[model samples]
Target: MKVTFPHMGNMSIVIKALLKELNIEFIPPPPITKRTLSLGVQHAPESACLPLKINIGNFLEAAEKGADTVLMAGGIGPCRFGYYNQVQREILNDLGVNLNMIVLEPPDNHIGELLKRLRTLTGSNSWWRVVKAIRFAFAKCEALDDLERAASRIRCRELQRGDVDRVYAQGCQAIDQATTPKEIVQCRDEYLTKMRSLPLDHLKRPIRIGIVGEIYTLLEPSSNGFMEKNLGRLGAEVSRSIYLSEWVNEHLLKGLLPVKGHKLTRKRAQPYLNCMVGGHGQESIGATIEYAQQGYDGVIQVGPLTCMPEIVAQSIMPNVEKDFHIPVLTIYVDEQTGEAGLMTRLEAFVDMLERRKRIQVESGLQG
Candidate 1:
């Protein structure tokens, strides 16, 4: 089966590693572009959330590259994501695109069914071989995430505007090229060292910003208008609420393994939102509170337009801002969102944060 999957930051790297070890033939989708967005917008329902549309775009583009099967993840919450696979499949069918979608559901729900899906996807590969492939891919994911977190912090302080991004890309390339776990670690460490060694302007004191929102939007730069890089370029250090491996550990591995993902995040969100309203609603609330406690200058909540969970979280953010005394920016994106307009909002947010910091300093309060 020639399979393809949606893009979510560095997730494609993990998938490529997994498929390679399984001896599967696959067609990787082209990097997302304006044409991808246009194709999705042209076909998707007018009110569909941004992620589902972009996913359609990814699959359609991959189909053009001769992908006959689509590999997608499944969700279990009230989030509309739980239905994405079915909806996307129907849409493709209506368009007469002859691709089959295989969804890998969360291990916590219907473990037997999940195993069946995995068995089909892996074909006749031994269970042990499958396990090793997954373990190695997870290692790569962790290493990539470490590099990404470091890059976010260092990028804002780099003497050169794009040095951190360039080095981070090189680091990802190195990790992607490595076949073994040991090599993955080596590449990660080597690039991390290179990232640290990059010259920094000590005078540049970056504003610290926490990003929390829908997972797809938060993880996919193209979908969110490259918010992290833009924030870094505007002299802000960025930390996201979720990463792929962390999400897998907390969400997928919890039932199979002794994992308590987002335990503390859930606790912190107890005051404003005690339950999972869907998507990352509770997590977003919790993360915002955590960022405030950590003295972050601001928090940005990004999601697709009409997303229920984020809309719930966004409604409560003004109160969060009042209580925590940290600025919060809520950005909802759709196909219509323009990079220039998004950049303007980011610029204003940064300016407000800098002003707030100066005011605190003048008032003899800790900044």
Candidate 2:
């Protein structure tokens, strides 16, 4: 069986590596480009979330290439995502696409069943092979996460203005060119080292705000124009919530795979998340509260216009901001969103943070 899954930033790299370890044949759908977006726009309903549309397009393209089966992860909750598997199944059936979509359902509390579902995908029962795949997948996840985090720092303060983007592009190319486990690790470190050499703006006790919102606009630099990078460039330390590896190990293997990241495992953030919240945006609300209590300077929530969960969060956010004394900024994105408008809000937000910090310093001095 040839299995496939949708892209969630760099998670595909880890997923592809895991499939290779399991001796499963698979395809990596092309990167999200205009052509991919056009295909989705043509077939998907107008109201469907952006990721849902892109995923449908990805499945259709793969099926046309003679893929017999689709491998997907499933969700559970009031979030629209919980039903995505069922809906996609029906949609593919009506389209007369003869294929089997094997979904690894959410494991709120059941790893055995989840393992069984994964076994169906791999067509193997060997414990050793399972062990190898899990180890390799986790290793790859960590490597991808390291690269992403380093890239964020590099983008924030590229000392050599002109070389900043070039170095970053080369780093991504190096990452994508990697083929083996050792190669992946080496490339991640090499690129990170190269980028760290560049100078960044003086951090200067900048306000650190964690960015949490819809995953697409959060992770995809193209979708959100490197919003974190922009924020850091504007002098705020940006802490992003979603990393490709984090999502895969955290969201994909809550029950099985043995808690990939040891550090984050102690917190058990999934319950408030309620199954990765898919595109629901409820996770942002929880993250806001959590980050505030941890003393974050502020929280920025990015969502596309008309996003339901974010709109819901917006209604309750005033209470969060007032009670916690953490500033909140909600930046909405769409096709029409432009750089100028985003900069205006970002500059204003930074100004507000600076002014408040000044007042605090003055108040402290008075006391």
Best by lDDT: 1
What are the per-residue Cα lDDT tens digits for candidate 2 across 219-269? 776566567777767767677776655565656666344533423422333
Looking at model 1, the pairs that clash are none
Candidate 1 residue lDDT tens string, 1-367: 8999998899999999989999999998898998888888888888999888888999999999999999998888899999999999999999999898888877655556666788879999998898788888888988999999999887889888899999999999999999999999999999999999999876877789999989999999998999999999899999999988888666655445443367789788889988889899989999999999999999999999999999999999999899999889999998889889999999999999989888877887643
TM-score of each: 0.96, 0.81
Question: At residue 15, what lDDT does model 2 achieve?
Answer: 75
Candidates in order: C-alpha RMSD to true structure:
1.8, 4.0
> Candidate 1: lDDT of 333?
92
> Distance (Å) between predicted and true CA of 132, model 2?
1.4
